[model samples]
Target: MSEADLIYTETLMQRGKESYTGKEIVILGGGDGGLLWELLKEKPKQVTMLE
Candidate 1:
């Protein structure tokens, strides 16, 4: 992944890590699936990808 990719993913994941647990998440425009992959590690209640 590119630096921007890492930065974007980590930045978002870190910010939401605590709040994501057992919560429903809606992801829009994460076509690469990187965000989804990381989000799953947090074990959220549900994940919906619009794209």
Candidate 2:
């Protein structure tokens, strides 16, 4: 990941726990499945990626 991507991921980490924890998350346009992998680290109820 690029520096900007890392920064953005860090930002998400800050907000993810409150918003995504234990919630079903659907990611649209996630062809590479990167977002799905990232979110899975948070231990959500479920995570789905659609391309």
Write model 2 residue lDDT over 1-51, tens digit each, in one string: 677776676575565446677988877786555566677877899877778
Every model: Cα RMSD to truth: 2.1, 2.6
Clashes of each: 0, 0
Leading candidate by TM-score: 1
Give candidate 1's whole-model lDDT. Answer: 0.86
Cα-lDDT of candidate 2: 0.70
Candidate 1 lowest-lDDT run of ten: 12-21
Q: What lDDT tens digits, residue by residue, belong to model 1 across residues 1-51?
A: 788997889897786446688999999898799999888888899999999
In Å, residue 24's CA in model 2 sits off its true spot by: 0.4
Report, for every candidate in turn, its global Cα lDDT versus the true structure.
0.86, 0.70
